[model samples]
Target: MRQPPSRTAVLKVTAYGLWGGAVCSAVVSLLVSLRFQSLAPGLDQKLFLVGGGMALLYAIGGCLAYPGLVFKPKEGQPG
Candidate 1:
């Protein structure tokens, strides 16, 4: 059986995931806001929706276990 993650390790992973997601979200938000004045209202809404959706997805990935080592499987491996 695998040993459980230590508190410090869990915190580190959580921090990294949140920090990375925040930075990525900020960059995407900035780019979207910059182009907001140029994009048609419909396009602007679509962009915002997609960007927010991606950010949420990233956040979810953050809470998930590690790649290969955890429950996550390696790429190309059968589920």
Candidate 2:
């Protein structure tokens, strides 16, 4: 049987996934802003806002997850 992944591995994956999501969202937002020339400026602005908000949230999640991976107590050490 295969061994299950460790907690640190899970945390690392979570952190990287969140960061990757943030990067993807930012790239998509930039592409949309560049490709779509809407007649209404507000629409473009709203799209940017939504994308930026998502990216910001994802980045925050990554930041939170990273500490868990970095600050894990060593075996036999008091947390």
Q: lDDT: which candidate is best? A: 2
Clashes of each: 0, 0
Give the per-residue lDDT digits (tens) of candidate 1, residues 1-79: 9777765466557757865885698579658956894767567667766777777666666655444333544444322
Each model's C-alpha lDDT? 0.64, 0.75
The most accurate candidate by TM-score is: 2
Model 1 clashes, total count: 0
Once fitted onto the true fold, the runs of candidate 1 whose alpha carbons sit more than 4 angstroms away are 1-19, 66-79
lDDT of 2 at 32: 80
Residue 45 of candidate 1: its Cα lDDT? Answer: 64
Question: Per-residue CA lDDT of candidate 2, range 1-79, in tens?
Answer: 9777766666678888999999999888867866664757677677777888898899988877774444653554321
For candidate 1, the 10 contiguous residues with the lowest summed lDDT are 70-79
